[model samples]
Target: MIAESLIQRKPPTKESAVLRDQLLRDLQGAASVSEPVARQLLERLTPHERWALLKYAGKGLRDWLLAAYRDAELSAAPGLEAAHYPELPEFLLDRLQDWEAKNRRRLEARIKNGHARAPETLRRMMVEPIALARFIADRGVDRWETMKMSDRIAFARTRPKFAQHKLKAFITFIEGGNPFQTRRGRPPKKAKKVIKEIRQIAVLTPDELKARLQDARQRLPADQYLIYWLVAKLGLTAKVAYGLTLDKITINAKGRVVIRPAEAWFAMPKSIAPTMEKLARNADAQWPYETPTDAAAIPVFAAVISERRVGPEIFRSETTLLRSSAIHAAMHYGQLDRKTLASISGVSLKTISDMEFLVPADIHSLVSHDLVAKRNRAILGSDDE
Candidate 1:
């Protein structure tokens, strides 16, 4: 009754009517909205208090949108705010707007300079500012440069260190130096060491590995099956596999097939060669189809349905498959010598060591290796877990 009375008190302006139409259109685009429009009594509904006239809806709609935003903030920082402030703080909002503008400018320059994935990388980075802003709002803290070093460290410790990297990158993009870099101090004298009888990584015996591969082949579609097969056989990291070109895999003068011949000259596994060849043949037929020699330039793995329209159709998630294989290989089959593994997989020694290709013990790999481990731990148990 109050909502209706307030809405009815003022005559709906023509601008409000147009804004309402835009709201309906945006709702249609969002995919989550499913409200049916009524022609009989259509009216403009503006939110009361704190919410903007732009993108305005009724009180309920405003609450819903604010609730969703707060939910996202909480996902990043579990206890950032006791309650959503009646209005978003001006400093936070203004800083975010400035950060977004800088992103746009930098994106344009990267595009002009021919950076291959400027759009995608910049788009992903845009989320970091919002996360940082929420951290500030939570503590009622502003002016980061002036914050106590201990307090900053405490806040940084609260957020996932992996996420903080992106935040650091965004800040460095504008500020020209990283504020979040931690300084080394004396180690704690009484730091505890763990003794583990159980292995954290799933290292399968040869029989188990074979059975798992066969099961994956049976369950996954043909395209993905081929990708998984290559990853398991070659021990290639996702970056190397996902970025493979036709020239990377070929028969040498000795009639032995070479995979990643430039770096490793590693022979392709005889068992998987026939399947890889078939996938290559199919891909050769479709892209640069007329020029078979150019098939190497095309992605070996791509989407069946085209979505990007203007760009390559490579399945970015194929990288996930490759990484997963590396992770599993680390547990069971990956090389213990980091240098040898790096040569074979084109994955670095740092990555191999970080992911515990040799040891999945208590000190480091137990807590975090990559974003996946951290999130998995969150789901598996608390931060301590």
Candidate 2:
């Protein structure tokens, strides 16, 4: 009964040696405090595990660690915490483990039902990180407050006309008001259909595309890079980009980016190939649920990083799988014909338009210049004015 209380997941390392030494000192009176027990635990569990045992089972020490070790030795990869994320509070991990175990069924169902966008919602926040909230607030961004739709669109880097349902779902999640929640909602857009075809998607200009790319390359990680790269650069939707298969993306003999037998080739950045390969290697960890061994045909952005790793069974959160600001970038920057973008991404023309943040050319041009002017002023003088 006491053994069940101190459920340490990892073994003890030098970092936890002090706790272990203290535990050993406290337990020297016990007959089971033998060298073999220490060795078995050291060889089996992690530094964290040792501390947990010391704290919990220290009073009523256990031979349970040895039995647990024997059981694990029977398995091939009994430990997958080798590739752990750093700086996560122990309490946060505890909550994650509990949630992972409890919500396994629900999570699997979500993956099945295609709930792959914005998996990082803080549904389990015990204590909000005041420092992080303060930092964003210091920059005049109050993460706690509900963001204006325009600001949300700007922040998402997508168009003003959002996929109403998807954005609404995301907003509902955010309106839960946790510090890590998105905390934004979609603003109403006038229901105007430009051409009744694909003219609804706002196209991005070349310069705007470059700027978006530069901003994205600097701000986003590999997975996010793929999302925007496909949407902003290649004109794919966030969902489409998130779910894009490697088989659907390839380079042809013509030295251009092409979707293969489905359509024509398009220009691609030189750096994309390497990133795709890296994404491939990490895909199993990120997209572990019912994933195929042959990952080449898998979704491009489906890997799970440790910070967001959800479970022993599923491995990562799919809730935050796909986020898109691409439509906004496309409409405001790429300015490609809506039909062309629709063709590239296979999203409905109307849906694309609805999700697009249609900034007029003059407004768009002015926004671009203002950013440049701000940058110049920061360098030459001051932006205080």
Best by TM-score: 1
Q: What TM-score, computed on C-alpha atoms, does each candidate reach?
A: 0.44, 0.31
Query: Which candidate should be chosen as best, given lDDT against the real structure?
Result: 1
Clashing pairs in model 1, backbone N/Cα/C closer than 3 A: 246-296
Q: What C-alpha lDDT, on a 0 to 100 scale, does residue 375 get in candidate 2? A: 51
TM value for model 1: 0.44
Predicted candidate 1 versus true structure: per-residue lDDT over 1-385, tens digit per residue? 1232235223245644554455445454443433332211122322211122212344354334433433332111000111122234776566556666666665556655644341245546656566666666677766544435565566678777787777665566445564436769996688566953433433344555576578767776655655655565456654445545554666666665556622455666666666566655544433222333323233455322222421222333344444445545654542444444555666665555555634444334333356545654453344595
Q: What is the per-residue lDDT of model 2 for residues 1-385, given as tens digits with 9 covering 90 to 100?
A: 3334335333345534455445554344342577565555456545334534433342124334423433444211111112122344444344334433434445445645745323323232211222222333444654435346555444445323333333443344345523224546986778897766533433445565577578767866756665556655554544455555544555456544444211333445567755654554333233222223222334445432222232221212222211124545555554445444454445465665455535555433444655656654553345676
